[model samples]
Target: MPRFHLVSDPDDPVVAPFRAIKERDLVGREGLFIAEGETVLRAFTRDAPQRVVSLLIDPKRREKLADVFAGLPEFTPIYLAEQGVLDAIAGFHLHRGILAVGRKPPAVAARDLLASLPARAMVLVLCGIANHDNMGGIYRNAAAFGADAIVLDADCCDPLYRKAIRVSVGAVLSVPTARLSRDESIADLLDATGFEGLALSPSADEILATLKPAARTAVLLGTEGPGLSPDVMARARRIGIPMANSFDSLNVATTSGIVLHHLRFLGG
Candidate 1:
């Protein structure tokens, strides 16, 4: 069992990392992120145990989380605070009554991550995906469809953001990920790694359903308003999902689910 530290003071130094969470959320907390809710905490413990730094909980909710606590390392600190104190410390109401501060793992380069995949692999590549909700949705979809990994450009929002983690229900922890440097060409990297890069575009003549899965495949998705950049579209094999009644576009997350689901069943 982990040692339980009782916290009554809102300004306690031990829980300082969690102070004014909303304000901290905007700037982010360096390499550390808040994992809120029992579901997300469970995912963190199960998927990325080593990254867990410490946990804070409402004393009343402690009994309900016995199973989850059993999986945590003995060295991890567990802090129990009353709901009022917890709210004051967090600067917001935390109804779920469970939170964990976790550290981000060392990043893997896009090329290195791709090279480490199996002979047959499917990867989700994101360009300029700034919204945390969309990022989380894409990760959730990727995990559900058995994607080998996810690659994000440097401009993409941090997947470890608390809202994104909760939106994905911990998929951000489970999915393997790599980030591309600003100077790195996402297209060039995927092509060089022997991945057939399929760029999703509304204007493409080829239908996504008609394409066969390659030995190694990377599905490239872009931000909301403007789709993939012209440069990416030029280098990648452009494909589109067929739509009726002239519906030309879908949200990137929804599109990812459809494409990944289709690709999952395709014979390589």
Candidate 2:
């Protein structure tokens, strides 16, 4: 069984792994992530079932979390502490009253994630999307809107970053994601997969409305300021959401949500 220990200080050895996750290069490695808050913790337990490694929660929250922990593997640790102790050891006030660390699960290739879908699918490809909040928001929307999968191009921030995981409310764990080590590899993968790589930009004459819904599409987005890289734009067919004001461009996450919703409900 996973070890359960009471911690009196923030520097407790048990908390070291949580602190290290902030600066670690965990992607594509065998390690895992730290997920905080009751919502995220419960979600992880629900989705993974047998994968949760350890859970540190305020003793008061245990009754609430019991259903989430039932029928899991015997080694899964459900560590409990006083509210004050839990908060102090976490290095912050407990917002959701719980935190858990899970081992990284095996990942699928970018091509495989898309190919597994049976019908025309709208997937998201992020190029240089460095903001964890933006990535999280995008992932939340992707899951809500039925996007097939998410692909991160080179130079993007880690999807498993603590802020990203919290912002995503642990939705990143449920959605399939693949990170390409190089930007060129993403373009090559998309081309080889027969996905219509459509770059979302304000400069394009073609809008989401102009496209047919039946087409298998991959929407490529970038950060708010620089937008999609020139190289990525070259590889993608230029398309816009057709805003009324000439000066306004939707935030990348907002644009992604709108586009995904349109595809999900309107098939456009």
* Cα lDDT of model 1 by residue, 21-124, tens digit: 99999998988999999889988999888788999999999999888888888878999999999999999998988889999888888888899999999999
lDDT tens digits, residue span 214-235, model 2:
4778888888788877767887
Alpha-carbon runs more than 4 Å astray in model 2: 1-16, 19-30
lDDT (Cα) of model 2: 0.75
Number of colliding residue pairs in each model: 0, 0
> 184 in model 1: Cα distance from truth in Å?
0.4
For candidate 1, the TM-score is: 0.97
Best-fitting candidate, scored by lDDT? 1
Clashes by residue pair, model 1: none
Q: After superposition, how far is residue 119 of candidate 1 from its true place, in Å?
A: 0.7
Residue 91 of candidate 1: its Cα lDDT?
A: 94
